[model samples]
Target: MVDLTALLADLAAESAQLDALVVALPPDAWRRPTPAPGWTIAHQIAHLAWTDHVARLAATDPAAFYGSVIAAPDPARLVDDGAAEFLAPSARLLARWRSGRTALAEALAAVPPGEKLPWYGTRMSATSMATARIMETWAHGEDVAEALGVTRTPTARLRHVAHLGFRTLGHGFAAHGRAAPTAPVRVTLTAPDGSTWAFGPADAADQVAGPALDFCLLVTQRRHRADLALVATGPTADEWLDVAQAFAGPPGAGRKPGAGRRAGARA
Candidate 1:
């Protein structure tokens, strides 16, 4: 079973760390373009804040949450607001983002474990809510780090993201008008802290293994699986890499070798 408390705690901690990172950036730097095409640092943080607010609303009241979804404006509006606020000398935008995250964490803390909450058409337990938050923060954080030309150490929280990615692979393939592979694929992730995470049956016909950071980057589509030392032992393993996805809504355009090259590597 998922540990709701531990997951929530990790979400809060990671959110706080991300908040600090944004707060420390110079005003000009916040408007600088991020690795996510057309998104600035401010835009990324704003999306985080907005999503947290949406999640909080979803958790507390299901019907009201779905009601608001219909009226929600394009996320670009939030990004515009973020860019404007970031240009100001004060840190109001950062503070607002932090406040939203705090409220989100508090709401999760008060919820009873295993309680089902409405999210879009389905209901999710408090544990799933926390897990989703961690996955988003880590994914977006990678965008910020990439824009800034920095590297971030992987945390245990990444295991949750990896698990979700593995679970979603079949859906990813189907969305692209392709059939799921006939053979099962194994995944082994070695995290920075020396902890390991694995998915799939031990006797699966194919395998992929590497550092957790590399796995997360590949599955998130931030980096290509081939760019890292990810080992794939069979045809199924290679096929799975072509369609890995971490998000639920839709399969993003999968990364190819050109887009997958590591920063500064020759084209």
Candidate 2:
């Protein structure tokens, strides 16, 4: 069984990492535009806080969770709207994010065994919900870091993000209005510590191999697939890389091929 406590601990660490990045920014810095078009650093943090608040509701009061968020009149604009709704002054936004994430962790921990929490379109176990939170926190942190010209060092915590990337292959296809391929696609990535992290069938005909960080960036739509170093063998695997999305939603427009490159070099 997945250790909910351990997952929550990781979630806390991920949130804290992002919090540290923004907590000390000058009030004017909060308005700096991130890679996500019009969204600023403050929007990134607000989005996290908004999601955490709704997720807390999911774990504590499912009815309110659905009624408040899932039932929004315009589901397509829900994400952007949530960020706008939650946007606040830097100090207030930071405090709200910190307190909200803590409450989310407590609520997730108290969820009954075998219970599934309602989400954007589906239900998730407490562990899965926590993992998703970590993924978003890390992904959005990338935006914040990039906005400040910072390149974060990858860590083993990415194992969770990579796992989710692989598991959501079908959802990625569905979100793009494409039928998911049935062929097994094996993925082998070199972790931050130089250990191998493999997923899918060992004998699968299709395969993807690369650094775990690149794969996570690809699936999260944080970077264009071409900007990543991943190699895909076979048609299905190759196509999968193009439309890979780890988060639930419509297919993201993603970054341009060279948009996320570091100073004078590819990321």
Candidate 3:
């Protein structure tokens, strides 16, 4: 069984870190555009709050969760005023996010072990669900942090994000409408603690090796893969980096290497 307690703790810690950054931002900084085009820092926080609430519903009531998201008033404006209150006082919105995430943790705890919870695209176990939340928190946190020119120290917790990134390699390809190559690919990432974390079949001819930070950044769509130090061997693996995404949903038009660094929404 997955350790729900530990997973929740980790997710909360990441949330708190992002919260601290938001708390310290100047009022004007809140309006500054993040890497995600059309999404300001405030928008990022708002989206997080909205998603947390959605996560809670998914955990506690799968039917309603699907109904609401599928029938939302306007999917295009879900991140704007149509979803959560994006213009609420920053402090209040942040508190709501904190509270919602806590509620999500509680709901997840009530889930029967091994039973999957419904999410945006597929069902997720409590463990996978929590980790997905963590990944979203961290990835969006990067957009907020980068907008403020903040550089955070990478941590071992990133291993969860990295694991997700590696696990989703095929999803990334499939999401892009490409048939994922069946050939085996290996990943060797140097963790923040200097430990090596590797994935994929041993002696696999195809491989990706790089710093965990870059891997996480790539999968999160926070940075263009070409600008990072990550190396990919084999043609398929190499091309995969161009569109790598640890996230679900439609294949994102990833950041262009050396393109406008300050543009784009944190999709």
Q: Which candidate number has the best lDDT?
A: 2
Given candidate 2, what's the lDDT at residue 173?
92
What ranges in model 1 sit over 4 Å off? 73-90, 120-122, 180-182, 254-267
User: Candidate 3: misplaced stretches above 4 Å?
Assistant: 73-87
Task: Pull out the clashing pairs in model 3.
Answer: 36-264, 36-265, 36-266, 37-264, 37-265
TM-score of every model? Answer: 0.85, 0.96, 0.93
TM-score leader:
2
lDDT, each prediction: 0.72, 0.89, 0.82
Clashing pairs in 1: none
Candidate 1 lDDT over residue span 105-164, tens digit each: 888888886688776435777788788788888888877777777777677778888887
Question: So what's the TM-score on candidate 2?
Answer: 0.96
- Angstrom error at residue 67, model 2: 0.6
Ranking by lDDT: 2, 3, 1
Cand. 2 Cα-lDDT = 0.89
Q: Residue 21 in candidate 2 has what lDDT?
A: 89
Better of 1 and 2 by lDDT: 2
Residue 216 of candidate 3: its Cα lDDT?
Answer: 89
